[model samples]
Target: MFDQRKQDSLAAWHKLATQAQQWMDPEQQYDELLKAADEMEEKGLITSSEWRQLVRDAGSVFTGSQEHKTH
Candidate 1:
């Protein structure tokens, strides 16, 4: 059971990371990352805890992008 969950978490992270690299715009990437995380969770690809971690990580990463902030 723990092994299965570990696999799921790794898969989720890889998928989300790949999607994250598709967009150069931080805001758009953040939006799409959240959407992907939602889809992954809905499809049982990830646990809710994993989804929340992905959200928090993405938020912190993208939120720090220079392009995302207004001068």
Candidate 2:
């Protein structure tokens, strides 16, 4: 009975780990960051100009534009 329960726990752990790995995908992370930025803008945490800059920077990160990337 103990061995069976251990096996079940291990299987469940593997499933959760797999899901976590998938959830950390780079594109997914970028989208999530954009959504968070939107929420911040809605909450008035940042100005309109700042939000625009955030979107532009995020796009540059994925698109690999050196102009936007450099200081």
Among all candidates shown, the one with the greatest TM-score: 1
**Clashing residue pairs, backbone N/CA/C < 3 A, model 2:** none
lDDT of 2 by residue, 1-71 (tens): 65575455444433433343345654654565577557656766667887787667556544543342464
Off by over 4 Å in 1: 1-23, 67-71
| Prediction RMSDs, each to the true structure | 4.1, 14.5
Give me the displacement of residue 46 in model 1, in angstroms.
0.4
lDDT per residue as tens, model 1, 7-64: 7766766565556555557777777778878877887877899889988977876766
Clashing pairs in 1: none
Predictions in order: lDDT? 0.72, 0.54
